[model samples]
Target: MSAPPPADSPRLDLLRFLERVQLQDLQRTRDWIAAEEKHAVLEAARRPAPPPPEWLIEYGIGTGRPAARVHAGSCWDTRRR
Candidate 1:
């Protein structure tokens, strides 16, 4: 096997420079990600909620059973399975 390069070698210096450049790029990417997340949160807050469904189907107590009752969306007496 060949001996390793010295600590002060030009190749090592170039690698260190590349590492610093990549680190700066990584930090910039993280900043961009944070900004995008903040923008998405703000957009979601500004957006209005969707309207409730016009119809509701109440299922039976057991699995694979047919719907027990079909009521209007505004019905308040709906029971949980």
Candidate 2:
């Protein structure tokens, strides 16, 4: 084994090594996340999204109305008094 650096000497070799590893890991993680997003987008694109139901938009009333006046431009999930 080689002798350790003198106390006076700066220990930059470890820092450089760590920086390299950190950069590599960051890039790998970024690539992985990008791949996951692309896969999700592709899967979503492959499957046709169901069209919005006629009443789901026109009346916004499907489920039991908690309020008398259901707001327009909102889904049946949203209710307003």
Q: In candidate 2, which residue ranges exceed 4 Å CA deviation?
A: 1-10, 56-81
- For 1-81, candidate 2 gives per-residue lDDT tens digits of 999777555576777778999999999999999999999999999998786544422243469634344334435554332
- Per-candidate clash tally: 0, 0
Worst lDDT run of 10 residues, candidate 1, spans 72-81
Please give the distance, in angstroms, between residue 56's alpha carbon in candidate 2 and its true position after superposition.
Answer: 4.1
Alpha-carbon shift of residue 61 in model 2 (angstroms): 17
lDDT of 2 at 22: 100
Give the 10-residue window scoring lowest on summed lDDT in candidate 2: 52-61
Which pairs clash in model 1?
none
**What lDDT would each prediction earn against the true structure?**
0.90, 0.69
lDDT per residue for candidate 1 within 1-81, as digits (tens), equals 989999999999999999999999999999999999999999999999988778789888777978888888788866564
